[model samples]
Target: MTDGPIITATGVVKTFGGLRAVDVDKLEIRRNKITALIGPNGAGKTTFFNLLTGFDQVDAGEITLDGQNITGTPPHRLAAKGMVRTFQLTKALAKLSTLENMKLGALHQRGEKFWQALIPGLWTRQERDIEARAEAILQRFNLTHMRDEFAGTMSGGQRKLLEMARALMTDPRVVMLDEPMAGVNPALAQSLLELIKMLPAEGRTVIFVEHNMDVVQEISDWVVVMAEGRIIAQGTPAEIKSNKAVVDAYLGAHHGEDLSKVELA
Candidate 1:
């Protein structure tokens, strides 16, 4: 399932008011690999994720998925093209049942058509199949017990699991997770970590934005470091851990300086 880059970004740029959030000359996401995007709070990691996933339009440059240009494409359209993303703040529908939320993630549903809705025969079988698929996915995430419960009632970790489960419903080839472990409990974070490690085996390219250095070091096949909307350094985990640029991005110039002699602010 691996060949060349599953995703490519060239001269990409995004701006918010006067701030340039993402400005990259080029980047490539290798097929079937787990790539972690990491940096300090204002490094534009999430903004770049949005640009690639089409949640926000790019002010300049191009993005491609499997060799097709996808820059400026809407999120839903990008989903249909085998690219799907989960948000840092879980996007589970509060009022919808867990299973219903998973069902909504399925792309190109016949039931979504007005005329198809009038004829039960047109979408009934497909509806059953979708439910069965949803159930299987819920079971995989150990969320079968909450299948019929309102999404809002689940804990933060459970919501994160549900959001990841829903993303799977689309059978996406590329999965982009924005802070998937944020606000999750330790126990559930372990669970999420294990599940993420399995994506490449399922032939999916996984790109995630994470602040936890431990998690990044443990699972990432490659790491990209960003600073002030530009990529500062990138390499394997061990290499990135020792990279001077990466250290500077997170700790700044005074990283190794002793503070004992410094005066208090």
Candidate 2:
């Protein structure tokens, strides 16, 4: 039996003035699967991400998540709907303690009431549970040591890790990551890769934008290739490794960029 996709986009289009940033014909993120959106610079990968996450409106087309049409839902609404995304640039709450920042994500978990804000018992009941869960998450991400530290003091990769951990605090169904490995040092990048690998094990849907072919090959279950605001190729890592269009897009005739010997692994 085949399960329906967790996220689906069809005929999606987005234009910025004279430029068409995203023109994907169709893209599907399978339930509990890891999908990578890969492409060269200016491939429209980020634009597609924005459209799916509702950071920007779509020019035309449809987006369905878990059987509901969420085409133009705002980012905050989507977060409440169990779809949370992390940016390519790390978005740690600078002044908040690592643990406190994660607590904010948990506010989306059960109740977010103005009355509950005024009443002590309503929220106090869950505070212990929330704190336990948050600590567990930080431990899982190997960030327990920095739980009480200010988020601003951590390294770039640690902040990225914290971001991913915070998103999980909502118990999200789909995690859309925008270039999770960008600008990360090699050592921490590997740590992030391991975390990405563990995401599917936790039964969460993982979709990410990335330029690192090795990381893409390591973590992605399905690959979608985009170029010049259009999807040009998509397949498994091995298949994409040998595809002509992908090759042309990355290393065309005039560029003389030979990557045949350069293994993503």
Candidate 3:
């Protein structure tokens, strides 16, 4: 295993309208592992995401990636440093072709300058290499055939796949997904689940927020359960399944008693 956690949060807190949403005292994302963030509605998972990604400012806390303090860096800069995330809803470019959308991700890459190309052979070659890499990624996602199609014309599942493919265009170390299974068909949901599971195999720290317990249990190596804007439980999938607090918060306060009574009767 790697030596450092890919992401860490200490005393992360954020509030809106005088209501505290996320009260995670501490959180850690270990290197090269699949971590699931599961929570009930209104639990502030998205709020926490916004703060950590710089989409929202934190009132008090610290967030670090790979031991580097990146508490308040804007999203673009954070992405440049290999911290990237996919939206709960696919925010793909409606008018752009899928291939063009992937190409946009390569614009921020190093060594693509006019000066670098003035060498007569280097920069042009690198640009061409980027195109080839994008093509390869599209193929990997089974999107090569749709590369020329406008993003708006694709089905929701295809768009989700495209979004995931686009995130890879940045060569990130940490990939965060906000409900990767949302808006996807069952077949595509299965595919998305498999893809998320495969993320850590490639050495990227995978953290995803999802409410679908079946998908979470099938794919996640570690589960973090949040409720009422606080992390109430963290454990493996099986452990999370039996967590009384998680059941009460998500299912109902009487969930365990009902289940136990049913079992005994």
Candidate 4:
């Protein structure tokens, strides 16, 4: 990892009609560390995520990935440049087999080109390599048994796992996950949490949007709290736990209430 932030956002803004959805003066994500973005519903957490990932155009300001300007770069381009993200909703292609879905995530495949695809000999070796890589990742994710099965046949949690494993196919330096634990069973959520915690050890930075404070406290090296389209507080988990601003944002009149137990917004 580098000595500085892997991602930086400056003067970023996004508005929907008259309402500003995201407005941030500056934010920097440290390298090789897990950062959690937390807020109540409609706190602009997801909007900021979209702006950073190129799913939505920023209305203003600069976004940089490893010092290169990437304010308006599209998602596929970002993936090629070592930045990739998974959606809030699992996006596994329903009809595709698990292994096929993984192969699709591999970048720069010769078979992806029309003329090259028509000649099996031209890309056969590369295809085998891709499959082997996919199998290894599936094994790591404990999804090897589902390799030939249709994605639509898997449970919600398994589909989430597949999406995460596919993102790894790009060999991304930064992985952004949106609500990974949402809608997952407790056992699967714990499994996913463990996997997320392992990313930094594998040389990838993680930025995840989640409401589960327990998960955040367990895995986050830094916590950034937002409210009403702006970052209200940022600190380590212990510090954020005691920050008055975060408490007020989550529980207006109930200041002394336990922040973790109260559902944010």
Candidate 5:
């Protein structure tokens, strides 16, 4: 619905030893919409996510967020700039309390500096504010009861929820989720799906790597298909479902069979 992309990348490339993991020529993520990035196992979807979010360096390319060049910016710097991401495997701090982990996602904490932290007057009010915000988010994710529990003690699906909730602690403009549904149980999966769908309505753009076509079709406004480290198709979910290139990307060896039978990752 927005006039232009919220995030754009040109000539992006990432290499590992002799292999080029990602080689996206150009990509645009629409503002305030959910865009699903779907690809096969070795198609480099996750690698591309890393390059875009600054979790990994791009060998060559320019990445821009809201028209500002952010190429090679570090993850923390990117977070401060309103571009935050969650990992395929949830990255909740194992030993930290759930509340503590969420609080860590808040940027520019006065208590982080040694001298400023020593002065309770300088940071106490802000710390209270952060705690209040974290508590509210935990309640939204249904984790308020576990606020004081160690993050490592939670189930796989709960950790995923925690990771997503923590990313919002930064109040990001664009949230990139990598395989948010992987390992999540069905009941929790549905809740995650609803939460993701609600993000754009709350004024945040979402770009996610998902393997489930059903989930992609149900929630995504747009879909980008990738194969062998390159994007081959982009369109609405309906268009992507019918695109020959997309079908072939997923079922190259079985192209002669019914395209509907092809299971897209």
Candidate 6:
């Protein structure tokens, strides 16, 4: 933890026609630490992520990364600024090979321009470097064997790994993961959990939304709870577990129940 927050949001609000999806007054993500955003279904956890990452427009709010205002910044621009995110549903391109998907995560490719596309000398070396970096990341995630496989051919858990690996292609300072443990197998889930816990150690700030309390307790350095479009509490996993407001809002009747026995979706 640091003296200042890495990411901060104030007076943030989002709506969908008749529904108020998010209404956060204040939220701060600690630097170089893992923060878990937990809430029940329809609590606007993912919606808040979309707003922060610029995947969706917010109805009203201000968001800043490392003291620079980034409200309404486009997703690619945010990535260039060292803020990257992975989707809950795993947005791997099905038609692309795993390696190809990873290459797409690299920013500012010279070959992307029509004129530069015809000049191999302008981009070939850079392309090779990008490929090398992607391969190294693949090895880190233990997906080198599937580098040539189509992302669609992978199982749900594998796709999650691919998504996280691709997000690292930007070399982001802040990584936001939405429901990372969702739909993963037990074996892969454990592996993913370890990878996530290691991010802060590498000097990257991590803010993840997770429904599984056990996973939250195991990995998060800080926890924020939300319900009915508003944050109900914020604290350590132990403090959050004992928070009366959190219990009444998200934890519900499970107030006294063992958290390890509670299954959240």
Q: Which pairs, if any, clash in model 1?
A: none
- Candidate 5's displacement at residue 94, Å, is 1.3
**Global lDDT of each candidate:** 0.91, 0.85, 0.84, 0.91, 0.91, 0.90
Candidate 4 per-residue C-alpha lDDT over 1-265 given as tens digits, one digit per residue, 9 for 90 to 100 = 2788999999999999998888888899999999999988988999999999999999999999999999899998999999999999889999999999999999999999999999999999999999999999999899999999999999999999999999999889999999988888999889889999999999999999999999999999999998777887899999999887788888765444434444543
Q: Candidate 6: what lDDT? A: 0.90
Candidate 3, residue 154: the lDDT equals 93
- Between prediction 2 and prediction 3, the one with superior lDDT is 2
After superposing candidate 1 on the true structure, give the runs of residues whose Cα lies further than 4 Å from its correct spot.
254-265
Instruction: For candidate 4, give the lDDT of residue 61.
Output: 94
TM-score, prediction 3: 0.89
User: Tens digit of lDDT per residue, candidate 6, span 52-153?
Assistant: 999999889899999999999999899999999999988989999999999999999999899999999999999999999999999989999999999999
What is the TM-score (0 to 1) of candidate 5?
Answer: 0.93
Rate residue 225 of model 5 by lDDT: 88
User: How many clashing pairs in candidate 3?
Assistant: 0
Residue-level lDDT of model 1, residues 1-265, one tens digit each, is 2487999999999989998889998999999999999999988999999999888899999999998899999998999999999999888899999999999999889989999889999998999999999999999899999999999999999999999999999999999999999999999999899999999999999999999999999999999888788887789999998877677657776444432222222
Per-candidate total of colliding backbone pairs: 0, 0, 0, 0, 0, 0
Pick out the ten consecutive residues of candidate 4 with the lowest summed lDDT. Answer: 256-265
Q: Runs in model 5 with CA error above 4 Å?
A: 254-265
Pairs that clash in candidate 5: none
Query: Per-residue alpha-carbon lDDT of model 5 for 175-260, expressed as tens digits?
Result: 99999999999999999999999999898999999999999999999999887677877899999998776877677765345433
Query: Which tens-of-lDDT digit does each residue in 152-227 have in candidate 2?
Result: 9999889899999999998888998998887889988888788888887777899999998998888888998887
Candidate 6 residue spans exceeding 4 A from truth: 1-3, 251-265
Model 2 segments more than 4 A misplaced: 107-111, 252-265
